[model samples]
Target chain A: MSATQSRPEPKQDEVYSALASARRPKPPGRLSMCLTFGWRGMLKIKHVPEQLIDVTLTPVLFLLMFTYLFGGALAGSTSEYLQYLLPGMLVQSVLFTSVYSGVALNADSTKGVIDRFRSMPVWRPAPLAGAVLGDSVRYLVAAVVVVVLGLIMGFDPGSVTGVVAAIALIVVFSFALSWIFTTVGLLLRAPQAVMNAGFMGLFPLIFLSNIFVDPATLPGWLEAFVHVNPVSHLTTATRGLMGDGASAWEIGRVLLEAAALAAIFAPLTVRLYRKAS
Target chain B: MSAQLAIEAVGLVKTFGATRAVDGVDLAVPRGAVYGVLGPNGAGKTTTIRMLATLLRPDAGSAKVLGRDVVAQADEVRSLVSLTGQLASVDEDLTGRENLVLLARLLGFTRADAKARADELLEAFGLADAAGRQVKNFSGGMRRRLDIAASIVVTPELMFLDEPTTGLDPRSRNQVWDIVRALVAQGTTVLLCTQYLDEADQLAERIAVIDRGRVIAEGTPAQLKASVGQGALHVRLLDADRRDEAEQLLARALDAQVHLEPDPARLTVPVTDAGRATGAIAELSAAGIELADFALGQPSLDEVFLALTGHPAEETVDEEEAA
Candidate 1:
């Protein structure tokens, strides 16, 4: 039997008649196009639920593994260490999840969809900007999972405002960090390269920082290096805000770092995105 | 600067490192006409289309779509034109209807308007039933139809279809051809780039035979065929033994190179006109060589390309691929 034999043939007149009656209005403005692409990013996640695993499972596994596995050794008990480790894990998980934005963007560029988007008369940077913005949801998810799970694990943030401020900091930082990956995605030829490059570069920054252990306990030279690590600064700021009240100076420095990254890599990603074929 | 011209390009050039993907090429396509760029694979058809569609910046020269410079006023040109690439460029992760709706909304339709426009296009392209199915699950032909539909969400003044039917079967190819005809009938100017000569002959009002990143021959299909030599005359000898004699006799009689075929003992000679076919037939019969078949045939596109480029399109594709 013929494949899909029951499929009916569309009548020629019906097709022509429908096309003739189509009324095309003026194209949407820049913001509308940006929002449309942002929605597409979420739609893609909905279609492929596996993409949610990083934000969902990573928080659970990393929080549980690090808390129970190294909690008693690092501190006196799992519950005591959970307070410090949870905030750091939030920063770590959010950082790890941010790379997927670049991987997704790179994957999208290789598909036929980017060619169609380029041909459209919409805003030139909408797809890139929307992708970066839409990926904020992942950071939000990771942040929420960490906070809710940390509370259940007996890790208290002490105040709602403090938790909100810490999550806000992580999201802003993740948004800026996504630009770095976005630029990489735009420049790289393969999606796999974006992931590999992201992990290889980010792992050193994450592991060598003050996330897992205190920088004060390390040797003088190593402590000095860890003190200067951007991840260390971010994790420290996050812990301060999430635990007690953070100093304005400490919060301002992380914000400055995030703003600097956005300032440099946002324009760079846009330029490279424009040049991508 | 003619008002009737939809697209005008002068000395357009694009180079990729060491390779000049799109060499100095010029084209003048009149409004409401199908202009076909016929070439083999890697002959720069896609590259030229990309430049005209404002997807790639030309290294030299300039092009104007609807009087808007492709470089200086690319946004204006983009607003007035749409392009369906060789690959079906619709998003694969989204459903067919979702893809159309997304493009429609981006093209500025309101939520209701976008949904209505999408429904119309889905039904129009015979994709209404498959609207809910993800594009990755659809067949190639369906995806191609959806891609074309996506491009026309705004009903652009000028449209570029780059090899719209490259890998389609005959029926699906016909469907695409019908769509092109329907678009042209609706007052849209179409610039179609394809390797299939028959596709150009059947659809394009004018054909440009491009090879090695340059237009070697430009004319109507019939005009290009006539440029090679007029028509061809094929004669089949009844006796296999007299194949050589028949070839020699016809070559001398017609003053043309006669190609011999042993399968049917056939000899084909290029003739200037239908009048020359009579002379070849008379001479073949006079030599006591009974003819099984004799007919005057118009030159096919393969012959036209062979005559103009010194190699047929199929052979050129193979040679370039091998290289």
Candidate 2:
């Protein structure tokens, strides 16, 4: 007890030595910071493995349920439905899972991690960019699941080139779509709000388009809206690439929509994220 | 550039919607001195610290940290200064070790150097055992220690600690105080914000008493206590009805401001000399006021706050700040 009575006096001479050991040699470049933030985003998913359930289980279940449940009703056979619905499912799965990027960012912002990153001397946009980069894995996971499940269910792309190009296009589109979610996450105050907003905004885009059915079957006015829908264009582009019916014009249109989305949301997300506490 | 001052500001202001959280504040903190900003929760101490740390831009005025403007040269200021916000800002998903290493790496350390620095900090902070545990699992005190350690991944010349020991037990509080002492011993300029008067008294070489977003008083603790005069005299009346009579007697005899309402039937007045106590007692007896208790004591920080602001520190916190 006597030994604990007296507090230790702090020594003064070693301060410089201690600081030298902890010195920052140089500030990381913007690209390195982006990668670092991306790595952090992935680490969060690793720690909370439940976060990946959306990207993993949802894709498999959707492929099985939609291919079997709607195949006969719409396309006249399960095999025929697989060809039409698999491409749609791929787009839907990636689009849905990409929204989690916003939810996760919202959750992270509520905590102190974002503040720590902002306080650093590194590039300011690195954390936001890294988050999108890290969550891109979810998009990758969704894309793989849909393709593998579709191929196993007796679906054919008609050409390996078409399958590769379509998968590549889907991945790019998901990455672009994630920027929109990132913007929503930045604007919202709570993760639950981001999740709700994401689902509400994405549902209309996915269901109202030709992702699940032909637009011609709708009323004339409804058909017009569906044809102009961005998601509808993306689904059409995917169907063409995977079935040999895709026109260069259709794929080009999808790319332009992705570019437009990135152009608008990327700057907004970065601006909002910089202003985040 | 004034190399002797760690911080210099002129009329810094920040408003939240209709509430002027911080308004027209000025500060000059000399290098190598521990300056404390003492206030109640919503007194705008945290907002002022955030502005100086470059976390929030001020609505008016300007501030410089380590000679760099907080807004225009925020990047340079960030490199030279660090902040441990009122909220511990460490990553919860990462392990204590991983959190430190990640910040070290982000600060431009090589992988091996980052690991080495993380290990050293974990060992120094007595977090070696919990190094492998996720930060989310750490106790409040452990998390606070890690949060502060992360800020020093580079030994910043100036550090801002906003309520560093707010929720800690006495033992943990002492540990944080020791850390602050060590940092100052090594020439780091510290600006600590706290509601705990004793904490500021113990660690700060100078203090500013802030209320309603303005610095109402600024001085060393001894000077602030001295400004209230020699000491305070407490006189309790046996009959509640005679409280006013006793208060009048004391105020007339001592020729000083008298304070009432702190107790149901008590009279508190400032006295410039211990000799005034005798005069006060005689005056009360001459006025036929019986006393239940009588004591004379030196001023505490609480009394200092009361004398300066007409309200105690704990009760003066703005409602918005409390939320």
Highest TM-score scorer: 1
Candidate 2: lDDT over CA atoms? Answer: 0.83
Query: Residue B95 of model 1: what lDDT?
Result: 94
Candidate 2 wrong stretches, greater than 4 Å: A1-20, A157-161, B229-302, B314-323
Residue-by-residue lDDT tens digits, candidate 1, B277-322: 7977888788899988888876765677778877767665555435
Give the residue spans of candidate 1 off by over 4 A: A1-4, A8-10, B229-243, B249-255, B260-302, B312-323
Question: What digit string (tens of lDDT, one per residue) describes model 1 on residues A143-163?
Answer: 898889988888878789888
Q: Candidate 1 chain B — worst ten consecutive residues by lDDT sum? A: B314-323
Residue pairs with clashing backbones, model 1: A27-B107, A27-B108, A28-B107, A28-B108
Q: What is the C-alpha RMSD of each candidate to the true structure, in Å?
A: 3.3, 4.5
DockQ of each: 0.49, 0.39
Residue A49 alpha-carbon offset, candidate 1, angstroms:
1.3
